[model samples]
Target: MAGRVVPAISLKDYESRREEITKQLVEAAETAGFLTLIDHGITIEEIEAQFALSKAYFDLPKEIKDKVPHNLTTNNGYEYYVRKHFPFLAVLLCPIKGPSTGSIDQKESFWLQRNSEWPSDEDVPTFRAKTLNFIGKCEDISNKVLTCLSIALGFEEDYFCKAMDTHQPDNLSQMRLLHYPASEGAQGTWRAGVHTDIGCLTLLFQRDGEDGLEICPGRESHSSFAVGDTFFPLPAETGPIVVNIGDMLMAWSDDRLKANFHRVRAKESGHSPDRYSIAYFNTGRKDVIMQGPLKKYPAITCNEYFLHHTKIQFGHNAKKKQEAAAAEKPSVVAATA
Candidate 1:
């Protein structure tokens, strides 16, 4: 299935429709694994303002932006497009016959980590405070979502909330802003490659009119071939913030809930305007381990699991290439001989 749209799952008056909304949430998580959220508490104006602020940062000159190079390890600061970071694009989009020429597609992004080190600049003096303010709202929504999931699983309302309390150290979730430049005729390129998120859940906002996000159901859909017919545009962002279960949630649910594969296009055929999105990746402390309420899964700390596994999902091909190159290199013994 492409994606489901569940209307007005109220964040207010929870006592009124707790079971009703819980059923919708669980059904979407199990089936489509992706859903458009409405009545999520964050207002359209706030959403617009956040996007505008992100746009301002993104519009700054390249030299100015480069002041903060990305921290690949933590995914903090700015990142210039590198094909390997999005492995599925290399495998799928690059081969589609466009400007890519089998190389990485270009996109730029900024990641904001809660209470982590941040860059200060005169250009966007208010950037830090405003962004943080928006993220605070995002965290509240995510917490309520955790509660809903607990209800869906037939557990006490606070079961998941207590398990993933953000106040605890190492559990800080993050928000990321993405900018996809308008692409003309391209050989083959992609905005984001096919991959599943490693966090507990992801809340995505597509700038009002832009379209490029695509998703495929189930974990297996991330592989090369399955991406063709199965992939479809996520419902447009109008009044709906698309939400999906991520890998952590999948493991915690013993795979009862899914973390579906999703992607963004490198170019939208002939689109002229840039595409922007804000994504909140919901997760617990890094130290938190992957485990289910039923104890049906083995435990691995969130950081350890995502580092070894998430990178593989994003750049499995790149890793394979490195391995191949290493194996093919002539040994010192052979060279000396």
Candidate 2:
């Protein structure tokens, strides 16, 4: 069977045409698990400006970037690919690793929350103010999307928004600035591994001519890590933002929605250009419990479910490394003897 085509929905006149938009969004979420959104209130110029700022931040020296290392507890700050390994406890929460490759993702990222401390003006002058402003814009879009999803699920329009309230101290919604450096000759490495996002919804912005995003939508309903043999390319372009459902929403909708497997594969020629993209992950407050009205799945708190889902998604990589270390220990003893 042919793969589903990702639908594009317009957010123009959203206030007046909300019911129509909600149906389209829910249909896309149910079938393709992804969609392209246009006229979503954010301008192309604003997106490019944020992309430029992201490049400047990633271009800084490693030492400077390291100043604001990632905090496992808060899930904020810079994370370089080379130093991607997490503390034993943190490994349970880090879900970027690829199950097939048994290696870390090739890209680096800077995670930002509303309350996160900004980089100093000396390092990047406009970074703080511009980024926060952009985040607010993205949040506006997110809230609108969430409102639609809530109405589709037979709840009040503000139901999901209240659960993901940014003002809450434990809100987990965040924006990420990602940089996938050019891989001119690297082989057997993925820019990003195959996995489903753990949040409720994700808004992704990508540049033109830098295509690598692929999705296996046929496996959308699969509960495990298995994927279909055929994959479909979801090219990156300007103007429209790519939006997708995530595990949290899938569960919240009692499988009525999908959170399909996706990844960034290397080009056929083994060469890839530098790729920069921005992602806004909208998650519920840590204390909020998520479960569908139908009660198909057990209710679980946001943070607890995140950890549980990541463990199922990336736990094998940790176990694989441990086994390899254990196997090498006997050889080292023999060499010493």
Model 2: runs farther than 4 Å from truth? 1-4, 82-99, 220-222, 316-337
lDDT of 2 by residue, 278-320 (tens): 9999987777877787889887777667766655665744355
Query: Which candidate comes out best when scored by lDDT?
Result: 2
The lDDT values for all models are 0.68, 0.78
- The whole-model C-alpha lDDT of candidate 1 against the native structure comes to 0.68
Where is model 1 poorest over a 10-residue stretch in terms of lDDT?
Answer: 328-337
TM-score of each predicted structure versus truth: 0.81, 0.86
lDDT (Cα, tens digit) per residue for candidate 1, span 25-142: 7888886678777787888998998898889889999887777776554556787775544434445532343333234545788887866556575877688888889888887777
